[model samples]
Target: MVTGGAGFIGANLVRALGEVPQVSEVVIVDDLSTGLLDNLDGLPARLFQGSVLDPDLLDDALAGAASVVHLGALGSVPRSIDQPLQSHHANATGTLMVLEAARRHGVRQVILSSSSSVYGANPVLPRQEGLRPVPVSPYAVSKLAAEAYAVAYSACYGLPVLPFRFFNVFGPRQAAHHAYAAVLPRFVTAALAGEPLRVHGDGRQTRDFTFVGSVTSVIVDAIVRRVTTTDVVNLAFGARISLLDLIAELEDILSRPLPVVHEPPRPGDVRDSQADCSRLRELFPSVRPVALRSGLEQTVSWMSGHVLTGH
Candidate 1:
């Protein structure tokens, strides 16, 4: 079962999981709040259109399910700042409900998607799982609370759960039209339209952007092998690059220069983010890392055909 399966990363993961030979059926539970049902079009997966916070809804969805990938959460730091309680209810409380449901249903595996934003305000280079989380935003705090519940559940009960701390994950199906869109999708949209890529800060903030394909691949592998741990793992290779460098790379890929406009940094934004992937390597040594340029190419190709086609 995949929560938020109609969402950006969730949609990509649902498609990948559907393709696997070992997986027989895919069940998805999403409230269509942040997720778009169109993203799941033509995919061979069952959809339960409701939030994970509802016990009856979650119970009905998790019946006889082998695994649950909890990806349903309210995203965006600024949005969380504006609506802190809503974010906490959807993200933090929602995760607890999912965990409880998984435990009740006897689900063999549960993969929770936590965020790197939990490391906000921490000045540690190449963020490790051990770093003290000093969350700056309501979203970050909610994610921390979510992951903490997952960890606590695993410790209290012998529940097989892996709470992964995701870095800047991006690729196909990622929303670009929204006001709170990720930088890569936003940049791609602007560049394709011959508009200036509006950047926050001086455009030197670095991030370890992991492709959605790689993330799904690892997740599928984990589900197949029933890989579980009490600790959280960072899900990114050490491919950190600044926003300016990313723009330059995008220009190279498109074979045309793109314009840029600088804006003051927004509240609850991090300066730089990089992952310490040693733990990830230890867990999934067989998984190959996707290069940034190649990932960008895939994203551009998908966006060119899908997002750029029509209204």
Candidate 2:
């Protein structure tokens, strides 16, 4: 079962999981709060239009399920700043609901979608799982709290859970329509429309932008192999690039030179973040996710034809 299956990360994961022949059936649970219906178009998964907060629906979905992927959450740092209570309820409490449901249904494993924002403002390069999670934003706090809950559940109840800490993941299905969309698709859309790409702060902030395909691979591995180690693994490219440089690269891809408009950094935004995925290697020896440029090229090509053509 996949919660927030219609969301950006969740939707891409649904497609990837469906293509896996080993998997028989995939169930999707989403409230459609931030996720769009179009993201789930043409998917073979059983789509249940419900929130994770609904115990009854989750109960039904978890029944006979071998594993569960909890990806549903309010996924915006700035939005979380605006509405801390709502973000806490959705990311923290909602995750608890999924954990409880998985526990009750006798599911063997669950892989949670965690965030890099848990690193906070520490000057640490390549954030590792061992670092103390000093989250700055309410969103980060909620995600960190959820991570703790996942660990606590595993230690206390023996529920097999793995929390994947994903860095700036971007790809084809990412929604640019949302106010709090990720940078890649949003920048792509602006460039395609001949508008100035907006850069927050000085735009020198670096991020390890892992592709969705890479994230999906890690997710599938966690479910299939059940390689439990630190209970948290960084799913990232381990490569960092500044936002300004990333924008320039995207502009070059589009064959159009665009002006970059600088804006004040939004509150609850992190300065820089990279990941140390060495532990993941030790656990899943066969796991290797796609590189950044290859993934970006594919994403740009797909978005140019699909979203730009207005088809």
Candidate 3:
């Protein structure tokens, strides 16, 4: 069972899971609040259209499922800052509900989609799992709380859970027009249209931008291998790039300079973030890191098509 299966990452993951020979069925549970039906086009999966907050709906979705991937959440730092209660309800309470349903359904494993935001503004270069979390936003707090619940469920209820902390993931199918859209998609869309790209805080903030394919590959591997552990692993390339450098790379891909507009950094925004992927390598020794430039090229190609088609 895949929560948020029609979302950006979830939709990509659903496609990846279809290639697994051992997998028989894929169940998708999404409320369409942030997920789009177009993202699930041509996908073979049982769709359960409802929020995870609905216990009855979740129970129905969990029926006949072997494992659960909890990716559904109200994701966005600025949005979470604007609506703290809704973020907590969706990210924190919704995760607890999923775990409870998984436990009730006798699911063998539950994989959680966590975030690097839990590290907050700590000056740590590459964040490790051992560092104390200093969450700065409601979104971070909700993810941290969800991670705690996952660990507790594993220890107290014997439920096998593995939480993966993903860095700035970007790739095809990511929404480009949403108010809370990620930086890559927004920049790609603007650049394709010959519009000025908005840069917050001088565009010097650094992030360990990860590709979506890498994220889904690790997820499918975990599900197919049935990894049994309560460890939290960082899934990233471990390479940090400033926003200015990212823009330069995009310009190089497009063969044209993009106009830039500087703006003040929004609240709850962190300065720099990078992941210590040693634990991830230790857990999944076979996984290979995808280069940022390669991922950007693929993303730009897809975005160009989308722009031509007016999607």
Tens digits of per-residue lDDT for model 3, 115-141: 999999788889998888899999999
C-alpha lDDT score of every prediction, in listed order? 0.93, 0.86, 0.92
Determine which window of 10 residues in candidate 2 has minimal summed lDDT.
222-231
Q: Against the true structure, whose lDDT is highest? A: 1
- The 10 consecutive residues of candidate 3 with the worst lDDT sum are 302-311
**Model 1 residue 197 lDDT?**
95
Give candidate 2's error at residue 75 in angstroms.
0.4
lDDT of 3: 0.92
- For 1-311, candidate 2 gives per-residue lDDT tens digits of 99999998999999988888878999999999988898888998888899899999999888789989999999989889989999999999999999999899878888898899999987798898889888899999999989889998898888988888889999987877668888888888888778898888999999999888888887877776765543688888588999988987886777778889999998878899988988777777786778777887888887878777753
Off by over 4 Å in 2: 309-311
User: What are the per-model C-alpha RMSD values against the true structure?
Assistant: 0.9, 1.4, 0.9
Expressed as tens digits, the lDDT of each residue in 158-201 for candidate 1 is: 78899999899999889888878888999999998899999999
TM-score of 2: 0.96
